[model samples]
Target chain A: MEEVHGRHSSGWFDVCQHRRMSNTRSLPLLAPESDAAAGPCCPPLTERPFTAEEAETAARMFKALGDPVRLRLFSAVASHEGGEACVCDISDVGVSQPTVSHHLKKLKEAGLLTSERRGTWVYYRVEPSVLSAMGKLLTVAPAVL
Target chain B: MEEVHGRHSSGWFDVCQHRRMSNTRSLPLLAPESDAAAGPCCPPLTERPFTAEEAETAARMFKALGDPVRLRLFSAVASHEGGEACVCDISDVGVSQPTVSHHLKKLKEAGLLTSERRGTWVYYRVEPSVLSAMGKLLTVAPAVL
Candidate 1:
């Protein structure tokens, strides 16, 4: 039951959530251009209700971080010595290599993490812009205007 | 297929994700005690890697917001007048009342929103402490400490 549940949850995370935000070009953010280019960006959600497109895009990233394993993997990478980690370095997450890779792919696709091949392993780093944006979007902050 | 995808995703959101954070007392945050009591709380995720328990609790709330429709509903209710709204007011989400209620229950159960019954309908309001804690938890802000 746990295995089936894991498979289905990860599948949904990949298909429904990840696919929805596949086109970073179309993601609805406060500063789409800068955000896409990895610049500082994040419009406050308190300003107004999110449009249909924005909600879908933001929800995908949140969904990507929705699993405990993925959250731990992400945190392990984000909090690594240099703000990134190679597959070998994050091996302590207790999951198999394939599962780790799968979560990495989902995180990258959701824009929360970016990965690049380095030697024989893939290194992953948190996409600060996207992570910041997601946090800011969900923030129901005090009215400071 | 879309329906199946939606059902599966929402089901996973409800099952594994929701159930993990069902206990508010165990939620990870700067001030778990205060936050659980509806007081000010939430440290910062960037401060440290969340413990296994913290990761599980936090992921549940994030997963609840993974759906577009739920996001829309949450945003509408959050942005509604007085920082609260009834089922009738959030009708703009386009789903039926039951769907909205279900999502609201998920949000409420995750500690993001609180509710009270008044007259013919239930009124929902953002739990500032919980919402703030979630935002602070996810925020990878500049190290001010």
Candidate 2:
């Protein structure tokens, strides 16, 4: 059965999460336009609720990242060799075979990762737009004014 | 109790569940990256789990973004009028009041959001490094190459 979980792990999970968290926290303090290219447009969170469109968009991504197995798989793949990791590489990444595939599938649907087959291997790569958009969303911080 | 139940308003809940189901069948994918920066020092998830330094750093942020409430709150704040929202504005969003507070606190603790007292209103905005680093992390998709 599939259990609900969060996106980050500790130890190795720290790299991406660290990069992302520090990044997300920094922009609000530094400047405004840095993330404007990718982040959502609006004011502070405490100011109001997200609109339907915003909520849906963000929801889709979070839903994708919500799974612990998938999140770990993402970490494994990202940390894999050649910017891509084969399914063979992660068969033992602390989960069952089907679980790994299940996560890869969810991530693909989210458009955060894409795959291509090379012989017997299917490698995954991160979608820049998606990554940038995520970073952007995190950057939308308080307007000092 | 730490029950993060996503109880919907009956209709919305069903819709969410349905969407989740469809998403599962549609294409649960895994997003990976090939970073030009960071100089390729990490190992595979299967080969070795994430390091504590790595895990703690990453986990904090992922935990921040893991929840639906936090995601919505992040969006609402990011999309706010001036890029920051105050308590009054945030209180009006969906989810339970306590849930909202819980998420906001989490976000703040993760260093994504910061709060301040502006006369009568307590305002929240995105942190600086949090967004900046998030952007940088996206810019460079680290791969095993």
Candidate 3:
């Protein structure tokens, strides 16, 4: 997945490499690198109950996505071509530009997105693993499980 | 899926059949029966930007799950054996029974769980389609898409 973003030169990987140090706010909510490497952050909801700590972490991410405007903004960035979007390109969500920036910051703080400053514009990208991690969190295990 | 619940006899399907009329609160948030039949409620977030309406519906569901206590309770019932759990079996989440009941009601209102009263106890079941619908909402489109 890192190699797939080669077109961005070192910019994308630089963000990924520095994400942990700079984005400490995302540490509690984001799936750890180990979990991303292994699989979803935890087993499906149907497989077992979530511990209090697990519930807290997952709840933070869900809470960030619980707003309609934020959700729309997130979907816009997620669905944008090349799996990234410029704030200028995707900020038309019926709200003021500052509000959109606020929402994007919330999404980034929640670990659902990663952003970078490119020239004069800030570009947002959904971490490739986040969507699947969230999806898997709510997944119902197969009957055999 | 309907037939798979033969053990519950008519009780389960009775809830499903009457769900629309009785649980009108859930209607706005839940994916319609047609969406369930066809596939996920909408294209994955990465596949397309969500309409305001879509964002509203999805946000409602996510908001209901944004609380740690509610999420833990939901997980308890979801992970219970036989895909269902009696109220008495899952009310030990460090909260009062009434509080637990309140959380369960919110979950039901959000269309995450379905409840049926039998004798003195009410049983809750996670509608099989719901987990997958939610999972699909956050799924990333394959690179080919």
Candidate 4:
């Protein structure tokens, strides 16, 4: 396991170097512009009762973070340096690599994460706005002005 | 269904009046002081990776809000006119009364809410600090000062 982790870690560094040399533009799996255009998906729960559709959308995101392993993997990525992480760096959450990959896929599907495959490994990032959006969803509106 | 909702709504009003007249102190199921004493349970995920214990605790709260019905019910209580809501006022989320109670119980168990019994109704409050704590948990630290 250590050997595999080392190899992947080195592979990631190589990809970074390659990208710098070639000046290849990073292609995000989900367009950040689209997420911004979508706007805050729901008002703060303290602002008003969620519409059924809004509740469903918000619930999906929370559900994705409901498991300990998934939440750990997500935290590992979110807290990693540069607001992103290589799968190689974050697959150490006491789970098998396959399980780690599975959780990453679930997070991606739930729109909580965006990923790109640079070389042999995948890089994951929490969109800058996603966490703030979630915080806003649960925020207690400030005394209604 | 409408009739039942009306009855409950009136019951809540009655309870409110009784509390006002009798000068009864609200008895919160969980003391707000204890939550404050515990401090923020975990640093923002963006601040650092969570320990297994921290992730476990946080995941339980997220899991409790993971379901659509529970999320809706929580929103109902959270977004009600005041910081707190009577169960009677927020039980119209297209589920049976028992199911609504079940979801509310789950939320309380997760430490997301506190409740008090008054007359015929149970009043639920979002515990001002809990929402802020959750918001803080997801907040991206402000560019590390």
Candidate 5:
């Protein structure tokens, strides 16, 4: 993504929201406890089993990212120029245009990306909030004491 | 994973490391030329289209967590008491014994978990290093704007 003014140029407003770097230590609120039980709310994964509900939610997200094709397509869009890139650029990658388009659609459905049409071309970029949420789910409070 | 120090337990360490929850940031080391010469020496999904070698390495990892059975299994183990749980306990979670065993084996191969036998039963827990590394790949930087 293009770096202008020391930040991504796509839409700087997202800059004011959740962010991280190798700062794996920080995470937002916990995932809601499994809906199957009225048990106490979330405890870190280290603390106890993630409830069934939490597992299902997390599983869905991971499933979306589980594909090799989709993961790379996500990277290409998230790191492309101007903080976004059009379908024309993404199609230049080795994957077939149809495959690339399919992957992009998945990324969009998963809320990891958003797009806009610039004339005949469609541009895509990371949905920072969604990205941050995924990052948060991966957050397993730092190594235990 | 053995409990360490008495109070906090080594299981916590296992959960973080084995689960691959550690985060890493991809600080663009080499510019992507805006052309075809993408570098290979970067984090999992940056700089270039994933090579066969790279895709295999990455696919292997994603494939490890690709299954619903394994995802639930990993969470089950990561949150198990004493920081680990026996495969038998895992097998009892509504699925057949063989399916649980298979998922556990895949998780072990992917480095997301580790197993050890306690008498006749084998217990598995998250691998702290792997978890941490996985966590890093999803890390995002604070916008510099």
Candidate 6:
């Protein structure tokens, strides 16, 4: 789980690649039927049942946000100046420096946030594609709800 | 945590009330300077940092979604016919009956889903407001990314 810039970091990259391929392949398989059926056949929780793989993949991201500290940290970074913040900006979360970094590392591995080293400190920003994908998975249209 | 019809069933209700009250109370507190400042001041996580209470409340929903089995079960219900599914419909998830039920109960208690008894079967449906709130929390505008 402590995969900062390690194999865990590349796991989401693989998921990203798989998702891209799934999108490209599923689009052409849709038949000209009802609008829902006519659209691409990609699997999302709200649109269709989750495959086992999809469940595990999406669960990782949700697990990363499950902790209060991590959720707060993510919010701090997301609403920070220019949508990015360094460790110093988030020091107000009241956790230790190493704890904050540890949580940040989890967010990165789960593909919710990305970090970049800048001289003496590392800055973090929300990963919009991952967030958007998760949001869309859980989002049912208001009318349908 | 087994609060299907217990007092714990009302926990998320309290959280929801706190969130609504927070939203109403925070807006007027914002200084009339910048547009962001003038808008709602509640900690939706995207617009502003989360207070400790908001983090605790929102984290409960995400924690309920952290497990892979629970995540899949939720998807099964969300994607099922009429946006509702019974235990029988989700039995294909490769988990034992009790395990699936346990996860389903957690989802229900977290306010992500609602359950109703129909004869011998219990049906579950996603709670759109809670899902929408969580989705909006993580959803950043495309331009921001």
Candidate 3 residue lDDT tens string, A1-145: 4564423444544444333233223223344564322225566777788898778888888898899999988898788655677776677678888999999998888877879886556778777666777888876565522
TM-score of each: 0.71, 0.53, 0.73, 0.79, 0.64, 0.68
DockQ for each model: 0.29, 0.15, 0.41, 0.56, 0.19, 0.35
Please count the clashing residue pairs in each candidate, in the order shown: 1, 75, 0, 0, 23, 0
> Model 2: what TM-score for its first chain?
0.62
Tell me the tens digit of each residue's lDDT in model 1 across B1-145: 2453332333332233223222334223345453443333334655656667767877887788888888887887677656666665565666777887888888887777778775455667666666676777776646422
What TM-score would you report for chain A in candidate 3?
0.71
After superposition, which runs of candidate 1 have C-alpha atoms over 4 Å from their true positions?
A1-42, B1-43, B141-145
Per-residue alpha-carbon lDDT of model 5 for B31-125, expressed as tens digits? 33332112232253433445444554555555576565676788777666455766645554456667778888888877667687755556676
How much lDDT does each candidate structure score?
A: 0.64, 0.53, 0.71, 0.73, 0.56, 0.65
Give the number of colliding residue pairs in candidate 3.
Answer: 0
Question: Residue-wise lDDT of candidate 5 within A1-145, one digit each (tens)?
Answer: 6554442246532432222121233223233333222122234445455656666555555666677777767666665544466665556446788988988887776556767774455667666555555555556665432
DockQ of candidate 4 is 0.56
Q: What is the per-residue lDDT of model 6 for residues A16-126, given as tens digits with 9 covering 90 to 100?
A: 333322212111222444322112223557777788877777777788889989989988877764667767667667778889889988888776676877555566766
Please write out the lDDT profile of model 1 over residues A51-132, one tens digit for every residue: 8877777778778888988887887766664566666655546677788888888887777777877555566767766766
Could you give candidate 2's per-residue lDDT for residues B50-133 as a string of tens digits? 554443454456556656567777766656545566654556566678878888987887767778675555667665445544
> Which sequence of candidate numbers ranks them by DockQ, best first?
4, 3, 6, 1, 5, 2
**Tens-place lDDT digits, model 4, residues B14-104:** 4564553342344342345755322367789878888898889888888988998888888887776555677767777788999999999
Displacement of residue A48 (Cα, Å) in model 2 is 10
Better of 4 and 5 by lDDT: 4
Model 3: residues with Cα > 4 Å off, grouped in runs: A1-40, B1-40
- State the displacement of the C-alpha of residue A89, model 4, in Å, after optimal TM-score superposition: 0.8
Residue-by-residue lDDT tens digits, candidate 4, A19-43: 3333223323224467631347888
Error of 6 at B46 (Å): 2.4
